[model samples]
Target: MKKAAIFDMDGTLVANSPVHIRAFEIFCARYGVTDWREKLANGFGMGNDDIMRLVMPEEVIREKGLAALADEKEAIYREIYAPDIRPVEGLKELLERLRAAGIPCAVGSSGCKANVDFVLDSCAIRPYFDAAISGDMVSRCKPDPEIYLTAAAALGVSPADCVIFEDARAGFEAARRAGAGRIVALTTTLPREELEREPQADRIIDSFADIDDIGALLA
Candidate 1:
């Protein structure tokens, strides 16, 4: 009965969505996309490719390519976020608790591998995660369950035995589709009201600090 924990990056581990949003703004400005703001209104949970497709024209995407565009935008985000990267409240403590309980931990993120590595390394939590599945590693993104399943597999744990932590509606759906033991939504990007209205997560909390009944949540 070995169980594990899987966490999403971005709004889940750290509240870096603002920095990412800023990067997106800068990226779209350079590309002459005046409607970037409107396009990005529902973009928090999306992968870079989807963002590019949403904001950039088909010709622009064809010319710049998804990988290069993603790299450029994420580069901006990393540069902007490096100085401010810190774990959300109660993240380290929770990781320690899970580690002490002998539960393996992994990262299942929609960000690129570079973004994931940067967060983990910058936050000084790389050692806490045994595996990390990023957007570049999966063909299908969040709401598809591939990333979490891949992460769980890398950790040598079944998805049914893992508790997946998320902050976005898409991530919640992915956790549910993965058939995770538990799906805990963090009100980092979306509020509790929006998340509660969904049928994905088993529990919702503002931060890892509020995880008082870990046993109940994991059950």
Candidate 2:
């Protein structure tokens, strides 16, 4: 009957979406790609390689190499997001409560390990997480159950006993596909109304502060 909480890093635990988008824009500009804002918005929640494939031309990817381009963009992202790396409002409190309750927690994110490490370390919340599973660990991205399932395994919890906290539609669907016990939608990135329309989400809250009874919700 072990229970676990799995959180998405970017928009779910941290309010770093704008910084990520800006980093994409900067990277796009360097490569002379315009309309990056729209592309980045549409590509949100995708893995770095997927995003690069979507935005960068074949020739560019070939020239710079997929790993190289992804690394550069993530490096820029880390630099831009370093100073502002704080958890989303109420996230620390929520994590503390979960920790006190003996509920293991893990970060399951679509970001590469570097980006994930940067966020957790910068926000000083690394010690709270029992496991960290990044996009690099899985071949498929969100909307696929691989990452969540992997995280559940890493936490030594059953997928049926894990509650997933996510901010994107794809992540919600992924949790559902993983057969997670509960799916909590964070409105940090998407509006409440938008997240409400997602059938897979069991609960929707603006921030962790709104979740007054975390244990009850998990139960």
Error of 1 at 142 (Å): 1.3
Instruction: Report, for every candidate in turn, its global Cα lDDT versus the true structure.
Output: 0.86, 0.87
lDDT of 2 by residue, 51-124 (tens): 88888888999999989999999999999877768888888988899999999999999899998888888889
Q: Which stretches of candidate 2 lie over 4 Å from their true place?
A: none
Model 2 CA RMSD to the hidden true structure, in angstroms? 1.3
What is the model-wide C-alpha lDDT for candidate 1?
0.86
Highest TM-score: which candidate? 2
State the number of backbone clashes in model 1.
0
Q: Cα deviation in Å at residue 79, candidate 1?
A: 0.7
Residues 1-219 of candidate 1 have per-residue lDDT tens digits of 438999999899998878887998898889888888877767676688887788788898889898898899889999988887899999999998888878889999989989988999899999998998899899988878999999999998799999888998778888888888888888888877888897888878898999876566556
Q: Number of the top candidate by lDDT?
A: 2
TM-score of each: 0.95, 0.96
Clashes of each: 0, 0
User: Looking at model 1, which ten-residue stretch has the lowest summed lDDT?
Assistant: 210-219
